[model samples]
Target: MKKLIGIDLGGTTIKFAILTENGEVQQKWSIETDISNNGRNIVPNIIESIKYHLEIYGLSREDIIGIGMGSPGSVDLENGTVIGAYNLNWESLQPVKEQIENGTGIPFFIDNDANVASLGEQWIGAGKGSNNVVFVTLGTGVGGGIIAEGKLVHGVGAAGEIGHINVDPNGYTCTCGNIGCLETVASATGIVRLARDMSEQYAGESKLKYLIDDGQQVTAKIVMDQAKENDPLAIKVLDKFNFYLGLACGNIANVLHPETIVLGGGVSAAGQILINGVDHYFQKYTFPQIRNSTKIKFAELGNDAGIIGAASLVKRQS
Candidate 1:
């Protein structure tokens, strides 16, 4: 059986996996990201790690058919260069493809990390069996990927940015310098921000209010927990979040009419509460016909989505 290598590169860690051509992970490992010296060591570290793992597994370079990678930045698909990844401290274009191919002597491919994760979920997770899918990640910030007819929609290299969808005209400014983007109110940070602001103005008795009064750090999880416990303030914050999130997804569905909109990321870990809240507004906002066809669900692949999706890149070419 032919083998493939997958790499999910992030700011904190780089997840590596060896998989069969069919996308079954055979072995997986990770290494801390080295951001020192303007990230000059990043690619070299990846190269060395792959070499080490290959030797330990008693596999030769010829055993691997191809390598696929997901990186955090704007990827120049034609050139395989990552442009201006602030988290990786890459202020300039980095020739990731050339460097990795040279170091490994293997056919390599790359794409945005979120894009690959979306591909992964579509291929085998929540969106499996569907040719069209949209994946939204709600974490520190919001990220998204869109796959239409089994192909990634890379419109001008930023097509699937679901987080930047304008949901509020007078809401908070997002990190992207836009007002009322979904990220400002739907992300983990966004949820906390809403809770804090609402708590100050709310006179109602709630756990969130008490927590804030006691000077405790409020998190998205805390807010969700409080909401679950019937805290009025937390529920209000969650309602606002779900309203914007459902609104965003509704608009996206109206445009793409995808089979599934898979939700993932840290905030998504809120599980049923998050989905239920979003679904309520989603049902309210989506087009009548679309509401019947487009379904929203949690991603099943979890952290492994990136690695599997990266390998799918090689599979697509092969």
Candidate 2:
């Protein structure tokens, strides 16, 4: 059986996996991403990690067909250059593909993590059999991917940046140097920020208050838990947050008209609260004719989506 290697590089963790040609994960491992020194050192660490995996499997370099990676910044996929990864402290990187290939003697490919994640879902997860789908990941920050006509859209490395779209002109500022980006009000951080602001306004008689007496450090999870317990304040926060999220989804649906919209990332663990809320507001905001056709669902692959999706890149090329 042919094997391929997939690496999902994040600011804090490196998730690597070896998989069969058919997308079955044979082995998986991870290591901390040490970015304190500089991002240039990550290449050596990744090579060493791959070497360890190869040694453990008793497999030679020739045993692997191809390698794929997902990075968290603007990537020139055709040239394998990472333009700017603020979180990784990489201003601009070149020859990342060359370094991996030279060290492992295998062909490699790389793309934006969110794009690869969308591919993963389409290939084996919630988006299976869907020709057009939009994927939104609601983590510390929001990230998105667009698949149209069974192809990943890459427009000068800027496509699928749904998170940066201006949702509210008067809303909070985003880390991307934009005001009122969807991520600022719909992401995990956004949820926490909303919780904090709401806690302050409500003052007493809020479960969120009980969780944090001073409301100095309420988290998204706390908010979700409170909502689950029927806390009025928490419910209100989610209602507002999900309304924005659904509005965003409705806009995408109107434009892309995708058959399905897949939601992923940590915040999705809120389950029905998120799905039902988004669905409700999406119906309210979406075009009347398109509302019934666009389906909303949760990503099934979860954390494994990146690795599996990375492996699917090889399949796609084949």
Best by TM-score: 1
In lDDT terms, how accurate is model 2? 0.87
Please give, for residues 193-302, the per-residue lDDT of candidate 2 as tens digits. Answer: 88777777885587776666664667788789899998988998999898889999999999999999999999999998789998999999889888999999999999
TM-score: model 1 vs. ground truth = 0.97
Q: Per-prediction TM-score, please? A: 0.97, 0.92
**Whole-model lDDT per candidate:** 0.93, 0.87
Best by lDDT: 1
User: Which regions in candidate 1 have their CA more than 4 angstroms from the true location?
Assistant: none
Candidate 1 per-residue C-alpha lDDT over 1-318 given as tens digits, one digit per residue, 9 for 90 to 100: 789999999999999999998789999999999999999999999999999999999998899999999999889877889988989999998999999999989889999999999989998899999999999999988999999988899987789888899999999998889899999999998999999899889997888999988999889999999888989998899999999999999999999999999999999988898899999999999989999999999999999999999998998866
lDDT of 1 at 25: 94
In terms of lDDT, model 1 sits at 0.93
Which pairs of residues have clashing backbones in candidate 2? none
Local lDDT at 167 for model 1? 96
